[model samples]
Target: MRRVLHVTDCYSTGVGRAVDTIVGLSPEHEHHLLWAGEDDPAGKGFASTTALPGSSLARLRAVRAAVRATGADIVHAHSSRAGVYARAVPAGAPVVYQPHAYKLLDPRLPRAARTAVAAVERALGGRTDRVVVLSEQEARLAARLSPGAGRTVLPNVPSLASPGVRAPQPDGPRRRRVVMSGRVSPQKDPGWLAETAERLRERDPAVEVRWLGSADDPELTARLERAGVSVSGWLPADALVAELTAAGVYLHSAAYEGFPISVLDAAWCDAPVLAREIPAFAGTGLLTVADPAAAADRVLEVLAGGAVRERALQGARDLLREMNPQVQRQRLAEIYA
Candidate 1:
């Protein structure tokens, strides 16, 4: 079995879920994780996991040291921060950098900050043997970074050993709640979700909107809570799946993404998705609109139950047919080969 070393500086949300999908898809390969984050190591089936150092220079050194210690054949780094560490290392293993979402694409970052990040990414781009991306939009961004490295798009699909996605129960009662998953952060755009929630509440105070993850920003959580959106802080897989499967609709409000795993989770659980019109959702066939007001209106129309809701549900299921995990595995085999 090929010994693959997985490195990530982010373990809380998107990057964490992306890694889960990758490692779970190829269990035949031995996987080792080296992470530097507040959360304890949570590997799906890692042979081992090591903690990276606290400082930036130390973390870079630790990445080099871990490569030697593990004798890894391939180094897969998730997120831009870990990409820096992995690409900068002199280790001889092939390096694949997967930016869950480019920091340059984040709407909240300052212009100067983005420019600096872009410069750093371009500097290290040649060191990456292959840059794995999730969508065409992200692929274009990676190409702009540097022309030297090869680019591949591996769409995020639900991994194995997950809570079985309940088949779409057309005759059964669907829960009234509209839900979203992923940590509350600027990228997830809790502010916009809060605005949408308020609009939802104004129309129908009884509307139940729920968030299914922990808070990265307490202030954002407060905004959501004040808007009458209930936050279910970090449910386990089964419970989270149960929530998604029963919800009236899944809402994806992320301002930027490389195809969030949470959206795939909703699709897997047969929850109709009403998502923002970001490039990530571009050709995915989810019921999408350009603005929060339109999204809020769409959610209400969907909840009322009719052709609109039925079409959304059907579209979500059709999308799922294309996102089959086994097919994803076949493609992944090509990447790892």
Candidate 2:
């Protein structure tokens, strides 16, 4: 059996699901995953995964040991930290790095740190076999940073099954639901989302907002609660998908992204989108907006009538078929083999 090792700092449910699909199709491929700090329950059966010590050095050492033990032919790493650690593993295995979003996009990262990462990519990229990206925009960015390596587009993999949904319309005139899901850091900018929701509420008092994400900011959570937005941190996959399907409209309030799995989830659930006009988010037939207030207006307009919702749902369904996880895995098999 050909062995592969996937390394990442943390395991997202989306990532776990994708890995599961890959393993299902190509059982001949023995896959092992390693991450830092703690094991993710969602990652079970995706591969035999190990959670290493928190320190970078310790994590790298553990990954190296896994590489040796697995006799891996390819090392696939996700995120910047994992990419660096994958590179540190012995050169016997071909290395492939998948950066969901480049480390430079992190708002908390220092400018110097960003520059240093770029320099390191430039230096080590030649030794790397391929850099896989979830969007064409990310592929372009990777090419610019590591001109010596091959940049391959391997778009995000979303589930094929429809998200079962249910909801109660709150007691009000314009009872509509708006949903946003992601990590609640500055990149996601929950403040902007709250502001957008406030504007929507002005036009329609019954407009309700829900956000599902890792709550990185306690102050933001308090502020959102004050503004009447329901915030839930790290929901299970089934519950999260149900919420996406129940939402009258899904909002993509991110500043930047390679290709957000949440947007794909919304599409899979036949949910309409009022999304920021980012290059990666193009072609989803969403109500694109530059202004947050205008975004709010668009969302309200789409949710006001059942006919509009029906039309939007059809569009979302079309997009969902185009990006199905099974088809995406077939594509990856071609790339990997």
Could you estimate the TM-score for every candidate? 0.93, 0.87
Q: Could you give the C-alpha RMSD of every candidate to the true structure, in order shown?
A: 2.1, 3.7
Model 2: per-residue lDDT, tens digit, 198-313? 88878888888999876768887777777788888878667776677678888888877777778777777667766777777777665577777778877877887666666666
Q: Which candidate number maximizes TM-score? A: 1
Q: Cα deviation in Å at residue 131, candidate 1? A: 0.4
Question: What does candidate 1's lDDT look like per residue over 14-83, in tens digits?
Answer: 5776676677788889889999665555546888899888888998888888888889999998898899
CA lDDT, every model vs. true structure: 0.82, 0.73
Q: After superposition, how far is residue 293 of candidate 1 from its true place, in Å?
A: 1.3
Give the runs in model 2 whose Cα sits over 4 Å from its true position. Answer: 37-43, 89-91, 105-113, 159-175, 306-311
Number of clashes recorded per candidate: 0, 0
Candidate 2 positional error at 289, Å? 1.7
